[model samples]
Each structure stands twice: as C-alpha cells, then as structure tokens.
Target: MTWTLVTIPASHYCDKARWALDRAGLAYIEDGHMPILHWRAARRHKGTRTVPILVHDQGIAADSTDILHVIDAHVAADQQLFPAEPALRARVAAWEERFDRQLGPAARRLVYFHLLQDPALTTDVVGSGAPRHERVIFRGLFPLLAGLMRRGMNITPAKSAQSREKLQALFADVGAELADGRRYLCGDRFTAADLTFAALASPVLLPDGHPVIRTAWARVPPAMQAEITAFRETPAGEFALRLYREERRASGL
Candidate 1:
C-alpha cells in the first residue's frame, strides 16, 4: 500500500521527513496544505497538529522524528538515518534534537517575520504545492491567515532578533563540531543530525538543491537578503550547503 505524507509545502520539518523517506526509497504521495489548514489534515489522521505525518499500511507516524524512526525500521542498516552504534546514535539523537528544538523554530520564526511583511510573497512561499483551490483561497485570505500565523508563532520583532542570535550560536556550534575537518557531522557518514540542521536551516539559507521552498533571491527583501548572504558565508552554513549539494539524495549508497 502507498503511504501518504501530510505536509505544509514550505515547512522545513516536513522537508526533513521527506528527505529521510526519499533516502529510504519509499514511495509516498504527499498531501500538501497551507499553514492553519494543516491542522485539520493532521486531526483527520489522528496526529497532533503538525505537518509531515506519515500514514502507512502499518500505522501513522506523527512528526518528522517519528517518520525517521519508521523509515529506519524499514531500510537496511547501512541506509538508516540513525547510527547503528550506541554512542554514535546517542550523539546523533542529541544533535538532531537540539536542531529540532532550537534551529527549526527559530529559523522559521525569523523567516516568517520577514516574509509576512509582503502578503503576496508569503502566499507564494507557504501556499505552494497545495491544491490550486487552496492556493487561491489562501491568497484571498492571506491577511487573515498571515495574522493568525504571526500570532501562533509569536513572530514579533523582538523574537525575530532573538532567533537571529540563536541561529548564530547554533551555527557556531556546528562549525566547532566540523573544525576537525570531518566530512559530515558524525564523521564521513551523513546522519539525521546533518539532515535536520540542513533542512531546518533551509529557510534562512535557501540552498540550491532544495526540492521546494525555493523563493527567488530577487523577490526577497533587501534586509533579509543581506542576512541570508551572511549566513551563507559561515562555516556551518557552508557545511549545510555542501550537504544539500552532495548528499540531499534518495540514497546514501
């Protein structure tokens, strides 16, 4: 039976789940939705209000982390997202959790703070990949939806500034981990840690290889574009971009 992935077309967390599933060679149809609209979809699947809920023959995998575990159980050991070794697996989990807790929300808030300033751009970015009717409805109701999103996410200027600081700190942490000249976050092999960070950071960096969420550079506001450029120059940023270039694929092999 084919799996169905519930997703917000522009959500980085959804991208993380998509990346893992693709790498595992799983074929699934994605049911894409807009921001507030995704809650209804999630509820229909008996999942918490979040995108990237994977509905398979066996069961429902709620959230990106759960989706990864489901994929890991199905794939070969070598192709798993988590390391087979205990210590290494713990380290990967720690890193993945940190990025999830810290990077994902912060990056999302910061970008939304900027993107919401222009209703049209916001519609194009977040409303993408949904059905045409949804897109049209979203565009018409963007003012209301954007307000709801800002309030739900608490995307104030102060919070956006705080998120910027958090992003810098997390980037520095990644850079320190890579200072030893290791190819990937956990040595030569790419793991969930790397995937999580890269996918979560995609909104700020907009790396070339992303499947969705590729808003044109010209369309971005000047201030936001400057920040993206600065982020792209960092060691951590470089690392994430490289992973997108070389390893954001359907299989590690």
Candidate 2:
C-alpha cells in the first residue's frame, strides 16, 4: 500500500516524521500544505489540527511520535527507533519525550518570533514545496495568518527571550550528558532520542541542506544568524548537526 504523509513541509515535526519514514525505507507521497490552511486536510484526513499525519493502508498515524512507532513496526530490528532491550528503550523514550516537550516548542517559538516579523521571508520559508495555489493563498493572507500564529504561539519578545533561556538550560543538560564521550544522545548508536533532538533543533541550528534550511538561511535575519552560530558552537548543537550530516537521508517517496 502506498502511504501518504501529510505535512507542512517547513515544519520541524513534519521533518521528524519524514526522517522516520525515510529511515524505515518506506516509500510514501508527501502531501504538503500551508500552515493555517492545513487544518482542512488534517480534519478531512481524520487527524487533529497538526501536520505529519501519516495515512497508511490500515489507518492514520496522527502524530510524529506515532508515525515513528508505526515505522518502527515495519522495519528490521536494527532500524527501529525504539530499542528492543527494555532498559535502553526506556532511556531513549525519556530523552525523546523531553526533547519533544521542551526543545521543540522552545526552538519553534524562538524561530517564529523572528521569522513572522518579515512576512515576505516567512512566506518563502513556509510556502516552499506547498501547492502553487496554497502558496499564493499563504502569501496573500500572510498578515492575518501571521497574527494568528503569534497569538496562538505567544511569539512575543518576552516569550522569545524565555524560550532562549529554556533552550540554553536544555542544551546545557544535553551537553553535560555527552561529556562522557558518548556518540549519540542515549547511547552508542542512534535512536529516537537523537532523531527527535536533531529534528527539533533544526529550527535553531539550521543544518545545511535541510528542506526548511534551504530557503531560510539565505534570508535569515543577522541577529538570528548570530544566534544560530552560537548554537552551532554548543556541544549539543554540534551533535545534532552531525546527525543531520551523517544520518539524514532522502525519503525516496
């Protein structure tokens, strides 16, 4: 059966789902959509108002983490995101959950606080890979949508500063975990923990050649770029980027 992955192409969580599908060597069609407009598709597809909904033969996986579990079920043991050993799996799950709950939102708010200020640039970033009509709609109605996003995500200057502080603390913790010369987040080999961290961190780290990074970096604000540089210098940031460089692969869909 041909799977269909619904996504807002520029979204980090969507990228996380894509990476999971790719790692599983599962072929699927990417149904890309715009941000606010994606609700229609998500609702029609029987998912919550979120991207990265994987529609498969059996049913739909409504969340990125759910998609990973779905992909893990079909792949070989070695390719699974969750380890077979109970202890290792628990550790991996803990790290993945922490990154999802903390790192993901913080990175998103910090990045959007800057990107939403420049509608044209934000349009380019969010509209890329969307259908032409959706892109046009997004560009035309960006102001209203941007306002909704800011309000919804609380993307104020104060909130953005708070997100930065949160990231600093989280990254420090991740760095300290790596102080023992461990290669990956949970252990020696890659797991859901590493994937979640890298994908969530992509917003701030902007590792080269990421689907979202391609259109964003060229036009990133100077202040954001400087912040990104600082992130890249951190041990955790370096680890995420390294995973992107070495582990990220084409979906082949």
Candidate 3:
C-alpha cells in the first residue's frame, strides 16, 4: 500500500520521518499543510494533533519515531534505521530521545523567534509547499498565527536566549562525541541517531537542498548568523551538513 505522510513541510520532526521512509525505499505521498491547518488534518487521521503522521494499510503512526519503526518493518534488514546489534541499537535510541527532547524544541523556538521578526520571511519559508489557499490564509492571518505560535511555543526573548544556550551545550556534547574520530554516532554505520540529529538541526543549519524551503543564510539576523556560522564550523554541525549532502542525495527523500 502507498503510505500517506502528513506534514507541515518545514517541520524538523517531519523531515526526520521523511528521511527514514526514503532511506528504507518506501514509496509514499507527502501531504504538506500549513501550521494551524495541520492540527485539523492530524486529528482527522487519528484524533491526534501532530504532523508527520503516516497512514498505511496496516495502521497509522502518530509520531516520527513510530514511523521509523514502520519503515524498518517494511524494508530489508540492512536498510533499517535501528541497528542490528543490541548495544548499538540502544545507544541510537538514547541519542534519538535526547535530541528529540532537547535539540528539536530548542532549535525550533530559536529559529521561530528570529523568523517571526520578518513577516515576509515567515510567509516565504513556512508557507512554502502549502496549498495556494493555505498560503493566502497564512498571509492574511499572520498576526493571529504568529500570536498563537508565540503563546503555544512560549517564545520570548529570555526563552530564546535560553534555547540558544541549550543548543550550544548539546552541540558541544555531540562535538566531543565525534572528537574520537567515530564516523557515526552509534558506530561505523549510519543509524537513526545521525539522521535525527541532522534533521532536527536543519532549522539552525539551513542545510542546502533540504526538502523544505529555508531562509537564506544572509537574511538571518546578524547575531543569529554569527552563531549559525560558528555552528557550521563545529564538528557536529559539519557532520550534520555532510549527512545532508551525502545521505539525503542517496535516499532522494
């Protein structure tokens, strides 16, 4: 059966799911939606209020990690996101959890905090790939949408600052891990940990050729651009970018 993956298009979490499905060579249709409208679409599918939901003949996956498992089941053993070795699989899972909880939210809040400052940038990046009507609605209701997003995500100057600190600490940790010259997070082979980190870091890294539209590096605020430049120089950030260049092209996700 053809899988239908619902997403906000620019969401890092959705990209994670899309990458895994593509890596596993699963044929699927992507139904991209705008922000608030995505909640309704998600609810219609499984009474859940989140994107990156995957629907197939067997059942529906309401989360990105769940979608990874579904893709794993459908693909050959070598194509699995989870490692075959028990210890390596456990390590991959642990890293995925940490990045999912810390990296994803912090990067999202930090990026939105800056992007919301420019209505045009917000519309151009977030509304890209959405239906024309949805894009129009986003432009018309930008104020309300921005307000709701700020409130829901608790985006404030102080919170954004805190998120930047969190991101720095996480990147430092990843950098230290890579210092030993390990090719991948878990071991020699690429696994979900690498995929999760790279995908979730897209907001800050603005990875080239990402499936979603991204703000130009030059357009980012001066301070934010400085930080992004520093991040791009870090070992962890370079690793993420390399994954995008090599693995993403291989998967064609």
Candidate 4:
C-alpha cells in the first residue's frame, strides 16, 4: 500500500503537511476528508482524532511536524525546506512550534468566533459533512462546528490573550526580519517556516477568493480587517502572500 497522508480539506494543519510534502517533492497518496470517514479509522488506531495524520511505511506519523521531519530526513538533500546550517535549522524549527501552537490557535479562535456567525459559510461547512450541525442543519448529522473548532485549544481567556499577544509580538519580529527585504522567511529561498507562517496566518490574512471559506470572516470587523490588511502588507505578511501565490501556482494546486 502507498503511504497515505490523511488530511482535511482547507484545514490549516493539513495544509502544513501538504506544504512540507510538496516542498520536499515527496510522493504520497493524499486522502482529503470532507466526510472525515478516514479520520475515524485514524482514531481507532492512533488513539487521537486529528486530521493530517501520515501513515508511512514505518508507522503512523501523527503530528504535522513529525511527519515533516520524517519525510525531510529522507530528502535531506533538498535544501529548500530546512536550512542547511545548524543554527538556522534550530531557529526555523523553533519558529514552526511557535507558529503552530501559538499563532495558530489565536488565529483559529479569531476566525471561528466570527465564522459561526456567517449564515452562508456556516451552511456551506455543514453541507461539507462536519459530523453534526447546531440547529437547522441538524436535519441529519451532528451539531455545532463550534464544538469541533474549539476542541484541543483548551483556550481560556488568559491562554487566548497570551497566544494573541505572542502571535502579535512574534509577527512584529517577523515584520522586522522582512524589513531588510529578504525574499523568503530565512533567506532568499522558501523554507518550511515560510509555509507554516503563510498557511497558518491565512485565517487572519485570508487569501482573496479562497474556495473553502469563499467569504470574508464575519467576525473580523472593518477596523480589524484593516489591521489584517496592514499586517499582510508588512514585510512578513507580504512574504506570506507572495509564497501563497507563487508556490501555490507553481504547484498547480
């Protein structure tokens, strides 16, 4: 059997896996979930319910970063993903953790809180077979995307604020880094760090006409929307934007 990458369509975490695998030029069968039936199979074995689980020849690689690292080792010759320098590699790895765990959650919350309000988008997601629905769509399956979105974050006010602050501060640093006018996150080349930041930050600075959501998140007001745009214009966000367009098009995804 081919090694399979189980992912959820439009999931940022899933995008993380795809981004890594694509950059490494690794060939793996991708299983994208909308009904999420394969995810149930993963839960049965992996003992956790998460998308983007990789079933490699060795074993089940559960985490996005873990999967990336595993594939990366095999393709170590590919210098585009991770930096060749030890110090740069360390810094890039650290940024991956911070972005995935910190900025990821805050942006998720900021978007989810608002997404639940958009009637059209909500209907679309529910129609995507999200296991359940809150009210009207409870016509058949489960209920509430909110519950699904909220899971794993364990977000309290304190934690949420902390993540938000860290995300803002970290992005500020990234902005400063890009102010020197580098093409990618680390140097003139695209790295895993760039992919992580761009993919994770999409909710805050959503790509125009994204097919999945297909609309501006209703939660973000015009003022904050402006802030998001400004952030996108920042050196860091600009890099992210360019990467999204360039890499995405180059891959023909």
Task: Tell me, by lDDT, which candidate is best.
Answer: 2
* Candidate 1 lDDT trough over 10 residues, lowest sum: 244-253
| Model 1 TM-score on a 0 to 1 scale | 0.96
State every prediction's TM-score relative to the real structure.
Answer: 0.96, 0.97, 0.95, 0.77
CA deviation > 4 Å runs, candidate 1: 250-253
Query: Model 3 segments beyond 4 Å from truth?
Result: 250-253
Pairs that collide in candidate 2 are none
Give lDDT: candidate 2, residue 10: 86
lDDT of 1: 0.88
- For all candidates, the clash counts are 0, 0, 0, 7
User: What is the per-residue lDDT of model 4 for residues 1-253, given as tens digits with 9 covering 90 to 100?
Assistant: 5677776645677667776776667677765555334456568648767777888878888888888777777675545467778887887888888888877777766555555455555445423423333224432333444455456454455655565566678789888877776776675667778878888877667765333432554544575566577667766677777777777532213
Query: Between 1 and 4, whose lDDT is larger?
Result: 1
List lDDT for all candidates, in order. 0.88, 0.89, 0.87, 0.65
Per-residue lDDT of 240 in model 2: 91
What is the C-alpha lDDT profile of model 3 across 26-140, one tens digit per residue?
7888888888878888998999888889998799999889988888888878768897889989999999999999999999999899889888778778877678888888889
> What C-alpha lDDT does candidate 3 achieve relative to the native structure?
0.87
Which candidate tops TM-score?
Answer: 2
Q: For residue 248, what is the lDDT in candidate 4? A: 50
For candidate 2, lDDT tens digit of each residue in 1-253? 9999998988899999999888777889999888989999999898589888999988999988999999999988987899999999999999999988999899999999989888888888887778889888888998899999999888999999999999999999999999999999776789999999999999998888476555577689999999998998999999998988899886543
Of 1 and 2, which scores higher on TM-score? 2
- Model 1, C-alpha of 233: deviation from truth (Å): 0.6
Residue 232 C-alpha lDDT in model 4: 79
